[model samples]
Target: MNYYSFLLKNAFEDFKRNKTRTILASLGITIGVFSVVMLIALGIGLKNYIRQQFENMGSNLVMIMPGNDLSEGGFSSFGSSLATGIRFDERDLNTISRVDNIDYVVPIFMKSMVVTSLEKEELASLMGTNEDLFKLMDLKAVEGRILEGQDISSRSKDVVLGISIAEKLFDDAGNAIGKTVRLGNQRFKVIGVVEKMGDPEMDGGIFMSYKTTFGSINPDKNFFTIYVGVDSEGAIEGVKSDIEEALLKRYEEDEFSVSEQSELLDVVNQIFGMINSVLVAIGSISLIVGGIGIMNIMYANVTERTKEIGIRRAIGATKKDILVQFVAESVLLSGLGGIMGLVASALIVLVVRPFFPVALNFLAVFAAIGISSFIGVFFGVFPARRAANLTPIEAIRYE
Candidate 1:
């Protein structure tokens, strides 16, 4: 074997002789890396889930929200507009509806509250919109029927339950139809159950007529956001321009934003980026613990191999050689553990992907390898230095 390979092989043989110590040391890194990989995968899956939701909502959609929600990087709120921005009203929708190339316009009123059924009370996202919402989103009724224009015109307190919310509150989608559910202080009859759209925000939402919603928490008839579906992707730019011109008549430039689907997706990406960074920090706590274990094991190896170190020294092996050998062994243990963790986590994400969106990416792989090496070097230093500093005569006489 070449010099470095010999060093590695020697470390391997020592591990084979003390399998338990090696496994335990490696196990520390394994668990730590597992945490890191799984967390990053969760972040990636969340972004994917959001993108799917956007796609399901249809293409070339335009949205106007109460904020300068778009960043300089193309769109997402600077966070100031949603807090204190002017909300849109029905007049705003009317003005935007006259915009050429717009196929459908729906004002969105969102409220989060507990909806109670005879079976249970569950928190639900209530989406208030017109019948045109069903058309633009291409939502289908899995049971009963969706809202009709008559429902909005009459301000009827009829609701369409998304599949997840219906099941949670009534124990079955079939049982939810014609059932009475209380939202805030108003009781509404469930008129339909919408099919699962593979998005939690849609699947778990309770859809209601905007007219009826104005009677509940939205008494002033103002909306948080407005959705406009254009006829074609080619029409998106024109539609956005038309929308801005229409709304500018009543609102200031900074008080609102008109966004295309792609801009909203950019915002989603930024959000996931921040969230993943946090997850990595949290997961690294485990990596630090694993590093400590590796450090402890290396210290023990130095004690056990004192005489061997002394004999190599007497045979003209330098202190740097002894240090490098022990450090190599520690790094080998850490790297093996990291690889094992990565493989195990990949298998887990694959198996769980059908139900959850967890994904494995190249960034996660590179990160695992890089972090593992860093931990190996960081934790291996002190123990390797102690071994290197051992006096030849003292180490030889060590019993």
Candidate 2:
């Protein structure tokens, strides 16, 4: 057999002979790789899920929210805006409606409140918009009809519900229609239950007319957001500029933001990017600990094989040969752990994908194996050098 092949055979024999030590040595890397891969998969899945929901809203959709919502970091800006009492009023909405190349305009007032039915009560997101919201969102009712033009015009106390709120309150989605539910301090009759959209605000919210909210729940008549539909995808940039130009006349530049659906998706990606970086940093700690474990196990192996090392050195084996054999064993052990971690991670993703959006990435697979091999070389060198330095007389004399 070739000298290199013989060295590898010895390494494999070592693993087979000390099964417990091999498993213990590899466990650290296995856990580290599994953690890193799973975290990355979860991040990728969340980004994909959010992107899908945005795509469903169509390319022509534009949004105007209070303050620099996207600029201040996604979701975190909401509390600041509310604290400062900055919001869009009817004047801004009217100005946006007159902008050229725009389609429907829907002003929205959103708040979280308790919604109660005869059977149960739950905390729900409440949205006050007009009939135009349905047109802009392309939302359909599964039970009855959504808010109508008459409902908005006459300030009718009719409400549309998300499917989750419907089931939670009425015991079933189909039973929600024609029922009365208390919204804030007033009772509004449920006119429709909309099909389940993936967004939390849409899936578990209460929808009512902005006019209905006025003089009751929302006395100030301030809106949290405004939704706009452009006549064409090409006209989106123009509409965004026009809306900003209009709102800038009534409020400061920092007081509000105008963005499109795609921009919102970008913000979501940016947030996830930061989150994944943190996860990687945390997972690297596990890999380092695992590498240390490998190093310690390799040192113990060298100690146990001192007599065998002396026998080989006294015969024909060179120091380089002794070094290569130990290093090969270390690398093999780490490689096995990396492969085991990948298999375990893949199995977990497969199981979770049916209920959630988790997916295994090929990049993660290559990176994990590459990192494991590098760890093997880095941690194995000291022990390999120690084993090679043993003089035949001294190693043979040791007990």
Best by TM-score: 2
Task: Give candidate 1 misplaced runs (Cα > 4 Å).
Answer: 1-9, 16-20, 73-80, 113-121, 182-187, 285-289, 313-324, 347-352, 377-395
User: Tens-digit lDDT track for model 2 on 1-399?
Assistant: 998888888988988999999998999999989988988899889888888788767669998887774745466885687568477778877899899998889898988989999878899999988898887778899999999999997999899999998999998888988999987678989999998888877889899888888886888998988889899999998988988888888888878888888778777888898998899789879988999999999999999999899998999789998898888888888989989888999999999998678888889889999999889988998999999999987877776
Clashing pairs in 1: 69-76, 69-77, 70-75, 70-76
Q: Scored by CA lDDT, what does every candidate get?
A: 0.89, 0.87
**Candidate 2, lDDT over the whole model:** 0.87
